[model samples]
Target: MKKIVSKKDIAHLDQRFRANFINSIEGFKALNLVGTIHSNGGTNLAPFNSIFHIGANPPLIGMVSRPDTVDRHTLENIRSTGQFTLNHVNETIYRKAHQSAARYDTNVSEFKAVGLNEQFINGFSAPFVQESKLKMGLELREIKTVELNGTYIIIGEIIHIEMATNKISEDGFVDIQQLGTITVAGLDAYYKTSLLERLPYAKPLM
Candidate 1:
């Protein structure tokens, strides 16, 4: 039997329940740890599941920053330094990545708090997760506000990429599954993925 959750039912649902319900409905999400550093050199790391590909020509990426009603160190650091990193969360580091989401004092570096090592590449100001199998350094491009909900959409241009050469296929597809990258459902559930099959591009039948 199918269960129906009407509009009114959702409106009346408990806050935590509603959050879980809505978040899970979006299915699996890409999980990454965003790394940034404040002007004073205080580093910040936070896990985000909302990262998405914006375009390829410019190698753009986008992620959502929840409303700034409260202190958002990751967002603030990115804004201040105009640079950040996205580190893929894999099985070995997912637990530490998840812990990065906890709210800590502005002076605390989540990298140290969660026991993750920070790595810096030449000419990049932001830190990267040393344990991450795949990482990207990005420069902030734009921030758009969603007035309806007050969340901000942060967009960045990819400037540097670090990954294992074996993980890439001849055609440029990255085998994330082989890299052990994991995904998240709702706010807490973590999942590993498998590739079922690869199909050719679709075309109209003659």
Candidate 2:
């Protein structure tokens, strides 16, 4: 039997329960560890499931950051340095990536705390996860605030991408599943994905 949850039902649900329900209801999401560096050279890493594609021509990407009710080191660092990195969470490093979300002191680098190695490349201002199979360095373009929720929509332009050459197909498609990239449902549940099939672009019947 199908169950119905109205707006009023959601409003009255327990806070944590409502959060889980709404987050998971949207289905699987891309999981990436955002990496930034503090002015004092301390590194910060935080796992975000909200990274999304904004455009392709200029290679834009978007990510959402929670409200600043408390200290959000990742957001703060990005604002200060105008640069950050998105590191794909793969089977070998998902556990350490998840641990990056834990609240830690501003001076403590999540990479060190979680036993992940920090990697800098080609003079990029931010660090990348050495264990990640795919990594992207981005420069902040703009930050839009949602009035209703006080969350931030961070838009960035892709500046650099590092991955295995074999992961890209001749047609320009990336085989993320083959790279062992993982996904997430809701706040804490992680999942691995497998490609069922690939379909060609749709067109009208002749």
Candidate 3:
């Protein structure tokens, strides 16, 4: 027997669903993206999850920050210095990454609170996490304000990248399972990654 999914039925399903669909969709993929930014006066700040690399042509990366109902440290720091760093979260320092997300006053430094080492590179004013398995410093390129939303999307041009020896592939592919990367779920939970088969790109008839 054949069945068709009516538009009314689809809409009903959304209302009927008990669990938060978004939470399940996003976290199940599993990879927490951590970021570190330096303040104007040489303060090192660390925050975790919800960052992704967009392009390599001009070396671009994107970050989404929730708007400041309280104090916007990350957004304020980036706005002030126009620079930030992205640190990929791994198993060795998962606890530190989690700590970075804690609520703190504008004067408090997340980096110092978590006991992570901050590294400064020449030619870039932003500080990066020295203890991170992989980290990169970027110069702010663009900032787009979302419509009717409290958050902001930030874009940066990658100026420098540091990585551990064993994790990087010969072709430069970052293997999550090899690095033991930790991922986030429901805005707070963390988990390790597992290996799945690599598949080829899909093609359609011409």
Q: Highest lDDT: which candidate?
A: 1
Q: Tell me the tens digit of each residue's lDDT in model 2 across 46-125.
A: 99999899899899999899865222798899999999999999989988988888888878899999999999988788
Where does candidate 1 clash, by residue pair?
none
lDDT of 1 by residue, 71-129 (tens): 27888989989999999999999999888888788888999999999999999999999
**Model 2 whole-model lDDT (C-alpha atoms):** 0.90
Candidate 3 lands at a TM-score of 0.77
* Model 2 misplaced stretches (Cα beyond 4 Å): 69-71
- Please say which candidate is ahead in lDDT: 1 or 2: 1
Per-model lDDT: 0.91, 0.90, 0.68
Cα displacement (angstroms), candidate 2, residue 43, comes to 0.3
How does candidate 1 score on lDDT? 0.91
Runs in model 1 deviating more than 4 A are 68-71
Kindly report which residue pairs in candidate 3 clash with one another.
none
Q: How much is the lDDT of residue 29 in candidate 3?
A: 38
| Model 1 lDDT at residue 153 | 93
Kindly list the per-residue Cα lDDT of model 3 for residues 33-84, writing each as its tens digit.
3344544464656454556779999988787777753226677778888888
